[model samples]
Each structure stands twice: as structure tokens, then as C-alpha cells.
Target: MREFLVEITTTVPEGTGQEEVDRRRSAEAARAAELAATGNLARLWRPVGELRSIGVWRATDEEELHEKVLGTLPLRPWMTLTVTPLESHPNDPGRLDASR
Candidate 1:
């Protein structure tokens, strides 16, 4: 299956507290674990450098990748979901393809 990067963006409603955000994060983690159980999950990580955001790599087709990301988020009125294909790379690039 093709691998994709699923992006989960949350926009909390007005008057929301830190507790609610934590709760949503917890629920999202649980859902991610469920996805990981199956072959759909490739890897989960966060961005580095100046930007920071949780990233989940999932194996899915074009039509279903974004749909799968929806399951990773909580029920919120202002949440935005996005999915994009991830470029495949070797674990040890230095050891292979020395002809680069």
C-alpha cells in the first residue's frame, strides 16, 4: 500500500480549557494506537526545527488516506484534516546507493 502523512489540526471552540485539549489529545493517541495495530500505520512522529506538529504516516490509497485521518481526531466543530503521500527513504542512506 502507498504510504501517506496524515495531518491533524485542531481549532478548539471558544471558552475551551487546557483540560479539553488534553482530553482530545488522549483520545487521538488511542485512535492512533488502534490504527497502528493494523498494517495501515507506518510510523508516528513529530516535526523538528522551528515548526512543531504531530505527524502520522499511514499506508492507504488516495481516496482513503484523508478519510482515515478523520478518525484520528476528536469531534470538534473547527478541526481540519489533511493527508499527503510521504516519500520513501532507506533507513541508512549513507550505506546504500554510494553512486549518488
Candidate 2:
């Protein structure tokens, strides 16, 4: 599997009801859990004072990452995503730990 760094910014549309927003958020959380269980989502974090999230995700390819993984999110329509493909570094701490 290949890994990607994904930054997601959510913008709820004007005039959207709070109830709808809450429902979508609930669904999004459920979908994220599903993705994590399936190994598509690895780690997730939020920047302080920001409505955006940064996460590490895995997929067979970028296409799968977008279409199958992210596309499945309920809040996708309200989100802007920046995805960066990740490559292994020779001196990465995780790699060093694995090699030990």
C-alpha cells in the first residue's frame, strides 16, 4: 500500500441547518472509523483552532484513495482536500525502529 498525507478543510454552506450538520458529522465519523478498520485511514489530527484535519491514509493508488476512500465520506461535498503522496525515507525513525 502507498501512503498519503491528506489535509481536509470543511466549509459548511450558508443556510445549512445545525441538525443536518450534526447528522453529517456523525456519519462522517462512522465512515472514518470504517476506513480506519479497513486500513485505509492510519492517523488523524486537527490543528489547533482550525476546522481542518490532517491525516495519514493508505491506498493501493491515488485513484483509490480519492474515489473509494475519501469519496465515501458523508461530508465530502463540504470539504476541500489537499493530498500529498508519501514516500519512505531511508533515515525515517519508523524505518529505523522496524529495522532494529
Candidate 3:
């Protein structure tokens, strides 16, 4: 599996009600938890001083990440996402076969 860094920035369109925003955020959290359980989502973080979040995702490739993961986000319509594929560092403590 390849790892990726995904940044998601969300905005409430002008005139959108707070209730709708709350509902979407709630559903987004639930969906993220489900993805984590299935190993598609590795980690999630909310950055300080920003209306954005970062997630570490594991997938076969970029196409799968887009089609099966990011595309399924509840807030996709309201979010601007940036995805970066990651390569394991030779010194990464979490990598079991770092020598390779």
C-alpha cells in the first residue's frame, strides 16, 4: 500500500445555514471513522489557525485514493483537497523493512 498526505480545506458558501454546516461536519466525522476502521484512513489532524484538516491515507494508488476515498467524503462539494503521495524514508521508525 502507498501512503498519501491529503489536505482538505472546507468553506461554508455564502448564505449557507449553520445547521447545514453542522450536519455535514457530523457526517464527515462518522465517515472518517469508518474509513479508519477499514485501514483506508491512517491518521487525521486539524491544523491550528486554519479551516482545514490533514489526513494520512493508505491506498493502492492515486486513482484508488481518489475514486474510493476522497470522492466519498461527505464534505467533498465544500472542500478543496490536495493529495501528495509519500515514500517511506529509510530511517522511518515505523517501517518494518527499512533496509529495502
Candidate 4:
């Protein structure tokens, strides 16, 4: 598996109902939990003062990351995602700790 950093920005359409937004948000949360249970989702964080999230995710490849994992999001239509593939660094603390 490969790790990726994904930044997601959400934009609700103009005039969309509050109930619909709530429903989608709930569904999105449920989906995120499912992904986490399966180890596809590693970590998530929200940037201060932004309607965006940054997350670490695992997948076989970029295509799978997009199509299979992220594509399953209920709020995908309203989200813009930027994905960055991660490579292990020799001096990464996590790697060093694992080696020990």
C-alpha cells in the first residue's frame, strides 16, 4: 500500500437546503469511519478558519485512491481534492521507531 496526503475543500451549492447538507455531512462522517476501520484512512485534520480537511490515506495506487476510496464519498460532488503521494524518508521518526 502507498500513503497519500489528501486535501479536500467543500463548497455547498447556493440555495441548498440545510437538511440536505446535514444529511450529506452525516453520511460523509459515516463513510470516513468505515474507511478508518478498514485502514484506508490514517489521520485527518482541519485547518483553522478553513472549510477544508487534510488527511492521510492508504491505497494500492493513485487510481484506487481516487476511484475506489475517495470516489465513495457522499459529498464528493461538492469537494475538490488535491492528492500527494508520500515516500518514506530515511530519517523519519516513525521509521526509526519501527526499526528499534
Candidate 5:
């Protein structure tokens, strides 16, 4: 599996009903929990000084990550996303080894 670092910044656009925002927030949380449970979402963090969230994810490839994961986020319409694919360093102690 390939790992990716995803950053998401969300804005509740002006004039959007509070009720709708609440609903979406609830849905987003539920979906996140589902993804975490499935191991697709490895870790999530809120960065200091930024109105955004960072998530470490694992997927077969970038296409699957985008189509099956990002595309399904309830906040996608209201979010600005940045995705970076992670390459394990050869000298990293925790690096994945195919022979393992």
C-alpha cells in the first residue's frame, strides 16, 4: 500500500445555513470514523496555527485514495485539499521492507 499525507481546510461559506453545516459535520465525523476503522485513515491531527486537518492514509494508489476516499468526504465541497504521496526512506528504521 502507498501512504499519503492529506491536508484539508474547510470553510463554511457565507449564507450557508447553520443546520446544513451541522449535518455535514456530523456526517464527516461518522465517515472519518469509518475510514479509520477500515485502516484507510491511519492517523489524523490538527496542526497548530492552521485551520486545517492532516491525515495519514494508506491506499492501493493515488487514484484509489482520491476516488474512493477523498471523493466521499462530506466536506469535500467546502474544503481545499492538498495531498502528498509518501515515499519511505531506505534508511528509516520503521521503513517497510518487502522481504519482511
Candidate 6:
């Protein structure tokens, strides 16, 4: 299983309230759980920052990962998500070995 990162990037609507934010976040969490059941998601998280990015680390092939993200999330109607392969850094090639 290869690790890929799905980074959600989008603008929050002007005047959006905290309640709405919470609701959407709850929705995302549910969807992430569903993805986990599909053997696609290894882990997921939302960054605490101004950008409000939702990042999911998935263990699967590229196409399966992409399909899972596209099929599972609320990304299409409201947000834009960028998916990238999470590769080991040349200086940190042993990073993944720690998991085994």
C-alpha cells in the first residue's frame, strides 16, 4: 500500500458561522470513516490553520486513492481538493520503515 495525501483546499464563504463549520467538519469525519472501511484511508486530519485544509493519508494505488477521494468527500459541490502522492524524502528514506 502506497501512501497518498489528499489535501482539501478551498475558500470559506464570507460570514460563515462556527456552527456551519462544525457541521461540515462532522460530515467530513463521517465520510472519512466510510473511506476507512473501503481499505483506502490509512488516516485523515484537518489542519488547524487559516487555509482550513482537510488532509487524508491513504494506502492504495493512485487510481484507487483518487476514486475514493472523489467518491467519498463533499469536495465536489463546495470545496476543491488536491491529491498528491506522499513519497519518502531522499534525506528521510527510512521514514516508512518505522511503520513496519
Whole-model Cα lDDT per candidate? 0.62, 0.96, 0.90, 0.95, 0.91, 0.67
Clashes of 6: 0
Residue ranges of candidate 6 with Cα displaced over 4 Å: 11-25, 37-39, 54-56, 90-100
Tens-place lDDT digits, model 6, residues 1-76: 7777776665667888988877877887788688778766766566766565555566557786656565656544
In model 3, which range of ten residues has the least summed lDDT? 90-99
lDDT of 4 by residue, 1-100 (tens): 8999999999999999999999999999999999999999999999999889999999999999999999999999999999999988877878845553
TM-score for all predictions?
0.58, 0.94, 0.92, 0.93, 0.89, 0.56
Q: What is the lDDT of residue 13 in candidate 4?
A: 97
Query: Per-residue lDDT tens digits of candidate 2, residues 1-100?
Result: 9999999999999999999999999999999999999999999999999889999999999999999999999999999999999988877878735554
Per-candidate alpha-carbon RMSD to the true structure: 4.6, 1.9, 1.1, 1.9, 1.9, 4.4
TM-score of 5: 0.89
Ranking by TM-score: 2, 4, 3, 5, 1, 6
Stretches of model 1 off by over 4 angstroms after superposition: 7-9, 49-51, 54-56, 75-82, 86-100
Which stretch of 10 consecutive residues in model 4 shows the poorest summed lDDT? 91-100
Give per-residue CA lDDT, model 3, range 35-70, as digits (tens): 999899999899888778998998999999999988
Weakest 10 consecutive residues of candidate 2 by summed lDDT? 91-100
lDDT for 92 in candidate 4 is 82
Name model 2 segments beyond 4 Å from true: 96-100
Model 6: lDDT to the true structure? 0.67
Which sections of candidate 5 miss by over 4 Å?
96-100
- Which candidate comes out best when scored by TM-score? 2
